[model samples]
Target: MPEHIDKLSISVVVPVYNGGKTIGRAIEHLLRQSLPPAEIIVVDDGSTDQTANILRSFGSRITALSKANGGPASARNEGVRVANGSLIAFTDSDCFPEEDWLKELVKGFHSLEIGGVGGTVRAASGGLIGEYVDLHGWMNPQCARDGSVLYLVTANACFRSDLLFQVNLFDERFRKAGGEDTELSVRLRSFGYEFVFVESAIVRHLHRRTIRDYLKNIANHGEGQFILETLWPQQRWKANRRKEIVRSAAGLGTMLRFYRSYRRQYDRKRAFVFSLLDHCQYMARIWGYLRGKRELSSSSLRNPLTRDPSAVVYPNENLGSSSVLVPKV
Candidate 1:
């Protein structure tokens, strides 16, 4: 073993499905990090695409695990079980990390109590997706204090491995590929753990490639919130209400501000309208979450776990499959 083996630094966990087109590049980026991880594990969630073959090509450079079709949450749990590092870093297969990502992440753990840290995110392409991402440039060093942040993004986040085990990984019940990260983040905050924002560590997240794709992603966010609330009932009513209200208002304000600036820069009024429409889509989804919560609370018998009036049927088959394409980070 190398000298660093004694320290057993950070372990990076990447849960992949049909990511053949981008997974290799993601892994290559990690391997080149300034502070390379002690361990790198990729969990294949029953990928029917070239992902499985590409993983095998990596040889012993990365520990690859496979299982029947389970959601990313379950796949991540598997990676956590075999990781040897004290800290765990997570990034999606579609995102590319800056060369200093691992170094910046480790630097944030100056104190034992610092359980989590997140970095900045930018778009990979210069299209509509990139425009939307740029609109949120406040996420850059301009906004982050490098000390602490209200929220941390999973796409470029690192966590204390020990703390992760204590939280029991992400909720597998979040069958859809969304909001599981936020659900985990809010829970960690409730438990008194602090997350820092490492402004210098940047990730190029390849979000929705086109405008239509962006709207669809927003719609999924709605469904995810619904499922998350159903699983954690107490959290649904408490501080969650206040958080949602704040996020909603902030989102609307940000969209309007971005639209006016973008329209002036480019002569396209349509772009401004589309941006407004995206914000409206988000509001619609938040409404869906509210409705789903109300229905769940009013009709206890509707829960599939309960044998009562509604008698909801539980789908035995694993909800996540290789056919489903998750968002590009």
Candidate 2:
């Protein structure tokens, strides 16, 4: 069992940029946690707005660090540097955890062999679209003793301090808010680390509120896949290609089976129409991934933040050119 929460067994990192609007609420929630973090480190990834002022308002209740506009990965890495806890936990500036978030996280440590763990993430939206997405299992916990390539989401994840270094930190190369977390998790799984899934350690995510936001999120997923391709090259391409074919086939087979069953009971025409739509969406995602590969090849692939004058282009936007903000303690 995780030894009783010591002086500070966990270091929660929250990377903030342009979070002026909602960051204060996030911090406020963290301060109210049932098992408050040993230290709540917020990396201000060079915000150009009231984000800095709001952060300052927190005073010494939190540790705030400022750096040039590095992407979320860079900011998170910075948080890792200054963290003095045995366990490194992460949440976005936009996400909030259950009061027992830390307590439940401690519970997952029941196994000494578990190197890292993730919790359930529920959507924090009351809208119809949000309800639909949540129903589709966006944050549903996959109870697995070990992680598969399929089960990865960084928004509600935590890692042992040492295991994190073993994976070499989040891939900073992904400058656009996607896929680095999965790539790292996949890599860890490859090394035989068990990625325990803790259902009790729940986190609620404030997902994109609009269709535009959802589309942007999916497109970023494509771009992130592109970056992963560069790192693993042959393996990435092969794995993705295999997944595309298998999932595409399975998706088709599933629809066909549903159609046959429905045809025996009701209208064949309706089943055909619904099945077609489902297949089309699957095909579209596959096509998007292929296009993303070619597009990624053309991307300058240079992180604009660490570079020169380009960083000033969006001084007002605190969103990491690469990091997606989740709630942080």
Candidate 3:
């Protein structure tokens, strides 16, 4: 670790909703980090299960806040508002970071210009969907040709606190989990900030177990992409309907190739099923994109570009009726 790392206070912020099944384990892993954070903040996005009770059981080990059912982006923004550290690290409630996760993430901030650092996410358990997710690298960070990260998944990422505030935390318009992180990264990059990928910093993720859950996640991703295109019209790729149809038709051949590839590892029946699921994933994304377009067109939401990042006010800043529990010393 660099000398400056000692000077930088680290805070880990986890945003969760209906995470009663996994939040306890996630908190335990965070508390056991090799490089302990200055504070661990968990924002409960109006979970209707035992999540609140589980968070309470932690007592003073963590700072817990409860708010209405805002999406993950809103919950994260709330966490950021109350975070006291100079560095903010975000991991989902379903993720369990390795003992040295925090230590490795901070190591990437070797330069001042590096805005944020992110690590890899591996499946915590083995399941058919988990294997498919790992094989496809769905949760991995996207990087540029030069090796710099284009976007860091919030699942295992750390950012300079000030930089997050400068970009106005996260756009609340992104009422879902998928695109907000990418949008924030895009805005940061617009200001000439670079992100680094730290391969050694790893987190174990509890992937969606069922195909329905997996496809829903993929659909959310499609909607998120639509939101991105809306915010930056210039970045939007030209949608050629005829070309898309041709591509979809060609995708069947690609699926066959995947079937052949998977047969090396699995039985013939399982390989065929996985290949079909891969094609279904593509269709789900398309359905989500169209749904997003319709929703955006029908809603009265303002153009995100019209908001000034520096002047934006997040909902959590006021606290209002939300319950806040300060960490016990």
Candidate 4:
């Protein structure tokens, strides 16, 4: 058995960039954690909004850091730098955790071998895209080979401070949100670190509610995924291509299976409607992924600085000239 939970020290890190509207609420919910953190640190990444003023309202209740607006990964890395606890917990400024979120997640430590933990993320809004994401298991936890979690998103994840460093922190090159967290997860898993999915540790995500916001989110995810593919050719599906002669027939069979599965989960009418929308999202992801691939190749040729022996252009960030990571690879 593991030692008592009180023996552990945890710190919460919230990265804010123009999060004036929700940062206060997030902090409010965080302050209510059953197992309070050693400290709550919020890093303001060059926000042009009233975010700075709002954070000041919290006064000494929190530690606030101001820096040139780097992407979430950079901001998060900065928070981890100033953190003193044994565990570095992360949550976006827009996400609010339940009062018991910390208590529930920390329980996973009883397993002793777990190096990371992820919590369930539920939609706080009922907008179309948000509702679809909720029903589609967007934040559903996956089981790893050792019966732990396969991946953990920073939106509701905590890492053993030492382990986070072992994986080299979040990829700052991912100026966007989607890929950096997964990239870190992939690297950590490669090292055989165990991460658990704590169902009781829950946070409510204010997901994109409109078609435009949803599209942007999916495209970003696609781009990030392509970046992953570029960096890890072994993971690129295109790298392991196979010839499927009967494409149309195979698609039909897959559709049939999906329909059957959906029917079992919901009424036929509802299933059909949402399934169509879901496919739209999936198609968008494919488009983004392909676009990312092409753009990555173009960028690599256009920006030879990426070829520098000292640093790389973050493999596939494709942000053109924005940021780069110092990788030994």
TM for every model, in the order presented, reads: 0.75, 0.73, 0.88, 0.80
Candidate 3, 44-161: lDDT as tens digits: 9999999999999999999999999879999999999999887899999999999999999989888666879999889999877777777766677887787778899999999888
lDDT of each: 0.69, 0.66, 0.82, 0.74
The most accurate candidate by lDDT is 3
TM-score for candidate 2, please give it.
0.73
Tell me the deviation in Å of residue 71 in model 2.
2.0
Per-residue CA lDDT of model 4 for 1-329, tens digit only, reads 45434566888999999999899999999999988899999999999999999999999999999999778989999998888887789999989999999888887766535668999999877665666777766765556567767778888998777666545677776777777777777766665667888888999988875666777778788888878766655555552232231232235554555567788877886566566555556666666777777766635523212233453222211111223333334
Give the local distance difference test score of model 1: 0.69
Write the candidate numbers in order of decreasing lDDT. Answer: 3, 4, 1, 2
Give the residue spans of candidate 2 off by over 4 A: 2-8, 140-151, 233-292, 295-329
**Model 4 regions lying over 4 Å from their true place:** 144-147, 238-273, 297-329
Residue range 24-79, candidate 2, lDDT tens digits: 88888778789878899999998988999998888999999999886888888899
lDDT of 1 by residue, 166-285 (tens): 556676655556667777776556556678777788888777775666656665667667765665464354686657654754576767765776677665665675567556665666
Error of 4 at 112 (Å): 4.4
Q: On a 0 to 100 scale, what is the lDDT of residue 53 in model 4?
A: 97
Show the colliding residue pairs in model 2: 17-318, 18-318, 91-327, 92-326, 92-327, 93-326, 95-327, 175-322, 177-322
Estimate the lDDT of model 4. 0.74
Regions of model 1 farther than 4 Å from truth: 1-8, 137-148, 231-277, 283-329
Give the candidate order by descending TM-score: 3, 4, 1, 2
